[model samples]
Target: MDPLNNMLTILDAEMGAPSRIEKTGSWAVRFDEYQQFRIGAVLRGDIWLRVDGGAPRRLSEGDCYLLGDGKPHVIGSDLTAPASDGDAETAETGGLETARSAAADPAAISSVVLTGSLGLDQATEPLLRSRIPGYVEMKSSSYRSQVARPILELLSRENAWEIPDADLMRLHLSRILLIQLVRTALRTADGCAAAPPDRLLTRMDERIRCALDLIHRQPSKRWTVANLAAAAHMSRSVFAARFRTAVGMPPLEYLEMWRIRSAAAVLQSTDRTVSSVAAQFGYSADSTFSRAFKRVTGRAPKQYRQLAA
Candidate 1:
């Protein structure tokens, strides 16, 4: 049983099934509250996004933006343009302030922005942050041609009630979008190099994936670096070096993080006591688990459970 493998499995399970399509306005449609990752795809016409004192960025047709945290932001034709003074007072129709006051009405707009909100957690935020610029415009390009266009078309036709498979489709599309964005970011980060060309780092990714799979599959097992390295088919020294390069952390540190995260979910979602939860993740004692949990989360397990509950 590997703790890292357990963590990944939990991530997969805890990531909620994406919710119903929400019509926000003439210009915006969002996913249900269950989603932590939100994506807004623009179709037909343009939309503007105003983020907390930042200049508004206009999104044209076939353009998309991902909001990692689903924070309250303004999206409309003119994010900078002020609304009618009259509509400014009503809470719902009160203009820019009101846009964040409640979810936008999707039926009110013609051009659409597809929003896929996935509840903003650490695992998911990196995927969104690495790709989206403060504002990036995708012009006529093969990437956009192959990906964004199809997603926009599907979003345009599918109604919340008419489409039974909408949620699954959205999830799949989001995954595709994330992968494409990651590839693009990696390319840029690597200066357009065709490959990372670092054999050690490449091997490290494979090893980390193996380690991650082990932890996700069986979190209850007491895991160690020696065991994890063997799983990667490398000696500890080589495996550790490669894992650090690929994942930016040592294997044991990654395992600890995985354990703490797993314990957190159980603590939050179940009535299991701290001791039981700690033991579930292979902690020999509650005190040790508490210390580790506090170090990672800035709160003891008991405190976290209370707050989460």
Candidate 2:
């Protein structure tokens, strides 16, 4: 499987669903510095967004943004707009109690903006999050509009009509929209520095691709810098340097981050004991894993599991 797809699948597993948000013209909302990731898609009109202490930017229609990574941000028609014009009217469907709509006009919904929280790996701090900026954006014009536009349009159509399995269709389409959003984010220049047009997974040399594949396929394996280097057919030193240059981290360092992430997925999805979880991922002892997890995630495995629970 593609390494990037492998990593994204893990993220979705942890953040099983989205908390939908919808708004319209000149509306604004403020979100606290979050521990997890927040993603938003503007379906209509435009949005003026500003991360804390960051300059504001205009997000036009058909834009997808990674609002922030554990940073507070404000979204509105302008930076100075009130945090919230008023409470939002929420609707439910398919037994999922989400769908946020800002009813500024009782007559009609002026605009539609959908936002979802990637509620996963809050404790472990997934590796991809660090490589990406606190606030990154992907505008649809960068790629074919057909990719996300159709999916979202289908959602809009299904939502406005009372048709068979409309709720189920919307739910599935929303998830697809989010996946396309992230996939496009990885390709857009404005989305991430590490993911320039020819960077990310597109321009990976064969060696680097092989190494990444190995790591993703079996993160539980006892993978050392030398092992990855051998897989990449490079000396340990050369492989380490190249991996760092391309991926923004030394090979083993990235591996540790991946291990912690894999452990986190297991912890959130299953009822395994902390020791068992650590051992399953090749950590020699629970204490060793706990210390390492703390250094990276700011919490022990047990504590992280409890909080997630």
Candidate 3:
């Protein structure tokens, strides 16, 4: 199975309530650090989006982007306009207010944006944050031709509050849309022959992906550096270096983390004893597993299960 697909499958992801913003003429809003992933799509007109003081990027209708890095950013129709703090405006309006230019015609809405937060449970957040860049954008023409367009249409309906079961529908649609965005970003990166190696998810090295697949496929297996390297058809030293660079951790560390994380899922879903769960994931002793589990999850297995329950 594809490693990207596997990561999305195992991640405990949730979509926050989506909001729509309609604006006319020049306006800019500065949003403080989100510290979590954010996703947005332009429904109509144009937008200027800049993250952490980076160069401004224009997003036209049908375009969407994901922000994985926790940094302050700005989005507006006019980049030079004095930006008002988004939180302050939201508090004053109880949410993002519909903006219009003074004396502008009521029908002259120049921009409409659909936005929301993508939340990942603590156990799986690091796995993705390490692999994806701070930002990924999917152009209008590119995404509109793929599976994303239909989902975006559904999301637009949610934004309009025109559909039944609005909350439930929005949640599922947002999740699917986020997945499509990542998939498109990955494919776009993969197709770019001139893309650099440092772009992790975009130009993910096939060999490293193979190693990740092996780990996810069999978290219970006693995967050593030597064997994982051999499986990837690389020398042990080279494989270790490459995996660390691409994945942000040494091979064995990733294996242990994955094993513990898998065990945490079982703890919440099943009735197995802690010791049995530990052994099943290659932890020969309960104490050994408990320490590792606490290191990754900040709670003992039993305590974690209790909290989750």
lDDT of each: 0.53, 0.64, 0.73
Q: Candidate 2: deviation at residue 259, Å? A: 8.8
On residues 167-233, what C-alpha lDDT tens digit does candidate 1 reach at each position?
Answer: 5565455445554443443343333354342221233366766776776666678788899889889
Better of 2 and 3 by lDDT: 3
Q: Whole-model lDDT for model 2 versus the true structure?
A: 0.64
Encode model 3's per-residue lDDT on 1-309: one tens digit a residue. 555665665455656544566678788877788867887778789999999858999988888788988888899999899887765554333123343344667688888776667787554465577766788887777733345645655655565564557666765665677667555555545545433322335455778878887898888788999999999999999999998877768988888878887888789889999999999988898999999999988999999898776
Best by the lDDT measure: 3
TM-score of 1: 0.47
Root-mean-square deviation per candidate: 10.6, 8.8, 6.0
Q: What lDDT tens digits, residue by residue, belong to model 2 across residues 1-309? A: 666566665543222233344555556777676666676667667778787888888888887676546777777765665675222322242123334444445345554566545444432234355444576676667553446555544554565577767655655565565555456556545444435332336555679868987887787799989888988899999988888777667788777877887887789779988888898777878888998888767888888787666
Which whole-number lDDT from 0 to 100 does residue 52 have in model 3?
A: 84
In candidate 3, where is summed lDDT lowest over 10 consecutive residues?
91-100
